[model samples]
Target: MATLARRALWPAVAAAASLIAAVLVAPAPAHAHGVALVPGSRTYLCYVDGLQANGQIIPSNPACAAAVAQGGQQPLYDWFGVLRPDAAGRTTGYIPDGEICGGGTTKYAAYNAARADWPTTHLTAGSTIQLHYSNWAAHPGTFHMYITKDGYDPTKPLAWSDLQSFWSVTDPPQSGGPGGFNYYYWDTTLPAGKTGRHILYIQWVRSDSQENFFSCSDVVFDGGHGEVTGVGGSQPSGSPSASRSASASPSVSPSASRSASASASPSSPAGGGSGCTATWALQPSQWAGHFQVNVTVKNNGSSTLNGWTVRWTYTGGQGFEGAPWNGTLTGQPPNVAVTNVDWNKVLGPNASTSFGFNATGTAPASAPALTCTSP
Candidate 1:
């Protein structure tokens, strides 16, 4: 009996080890492909660093000395970076300078001081805190950054001083350029409520190689009192603006908000159109595969449609296919499905567009209806 129990325990232990190995080795998919810009490329890098503590810069770390060694130096980017009070302050905001490293051979960046006001919760003696970090670009690999508390120390290695950490953002090795965004959270504790002034230093470098790239940001935490002041800019905002939201089931209205109908004609082999009609007819729904559905779209509007968006609710398990400029559905659903059109297509006064997807369950006895929005 003892031998049998031991055999079972061995297998369970082995299985757990295998699961751990898989998680550590698995890689994330890359959003971008290759490196396009160089150090001196036409584009320059920008960054911002800020902090807030108990009303002063706590000189518990040697961040300042490290910054001076790197050649580029500046006082806290802005005096009024961000102010927060427990009773009212959100305790969060962007750093000053808005742009850190730019247009030259500058490698190091620094944020000299940050302070929190009185009546604020400060770090207790020997407590651990965490800092959150994120990357939003197409760089091929990960990198390392050093942190020093109090005043900067030149003799000690920042990386070895329990003050440094490394983070990786790439899944597969590639060239370099702009990649997707990566997030990291770090922590360290303080020695009692000894909060007056504090300093933080940040250094950027490649993950696989020693080559340094553009920008990076660090989220700092000291006990319960914290701030997001950093040495770089927040990721660039408002670029390929696209977003998606999902509805678990379909919905129907009592009266059709908008309707359209088309009259098939031979002269216009494709189809003919009228400018004042608001009615449209859909051909019998067809199955793309055991798990997919497809539908044809027609224009039944009076004027030309610069673009159109169609939305519908599904009762059967259904899914969508995402597009580069649009969203898609995938995987088998248990009950319903939905589809959304893009904003780029243009339909003539009576023109049309067609798009659809696969579903898990059988189509409803009555075909789901479609509605079009014209731009």
Candidate 2:
């Protein structure tokens, strides 16, 4: 009778032990929350690029895809959680170099990569734009916006020394997120003369808790009006531009400046005179001292277009950084031409396609006008 009673208890004891072990090994959930929406942060934009109707994440952008490969999709699901639990508003010495974008957390470490191919927001220098910071878990806090030093290198790991506080707002107004995102938003002006590529670092310090949120927004001061590229999709509904206010802080001079110049309006389109048009754009270069440009070809004719060729001349002595993508490169730098690939040779009326290439040398302050021809 005693042996039978002991055997009956064994199963219950084993089941209890298993439950305890499972609980002990489970990963802790991060308490941090919130991220930027417009001029989208790395994680936020990557999340947008990966999210699907079925609730599964599958990134298409090369940079976003690489980040997912390094860190599972959980980070994207918690896209607003690039934060530190005990930051207490500390900067510089607190977060280690090369991990500022990831908020110095291992969970978000994949976003710390120094690659330039991350999705980017395009804006004009000295322009006033609407700022949209996510409010996943609303709290009383102050938000600070910082810009990279003028000579900051985009291809290198971001460091505290590379940033300077430009705009700060406390307890801003909350509103429905543009494009279905919830956010605390305000308007601020970009620093003047900013060009090429730069990181807009956002830090939100909660007043009631020691937790803080951090994010990195890749942007180009290339005279754009809120157009985004490299993500390969449409932008959230609503305009990115906003009026400036006196309540916002004044702009400051940059500590240093890079040699590259920004295009006054990078997306200026050129008509081929044959109902075909080509517009040039800048993409993240991902290489030290290099930049990438994409040319979008469109057919405005009423009929189907069989083939097209686009040609341009760089005004800033820019040279090709690598082989062209989605098209064939012919001719030399400063005066180059690109032809359609087999897959994109045909286009219906009003249809469009794009091709890009990486290049080294100074990026022009104004997009070089492109000439398109159809054969």
lDDT, each prediction: 0.26, 0.67
- Residue-level lDDT tens digits of model 1 in 300-374: 666666544454556665443221111122212433222232321445555433432323344455545444444
Please report how far candidate 1 places residue 222 from its true position, in Å: 7.0
TM-score of each: 0.23, 0.55
Deviation in Å, model 1, residue 209 alpha carbon = 3.4
Model 2 lDDT, residue 167, Cα:
92
Model 1: lDDT equals 0.26
Give lDDT tens digits, candidate 2, residues 1-375.
011122334588776665455333322224436787666788877765564423345776678889989998778767778988899999988999899999999988999888777767666788777676766678898998999999888779999989999999999987642222346778789899988789999999999999899989887776554445545333222123422110010000000001012222456656575788987766432233455565778899998888889988877778864345446577787788888755456778987666656566766767788888888
Give me the candidate number with maximum TM-score. Answer: 2
Indicate which candidate wins on lDDT: 2
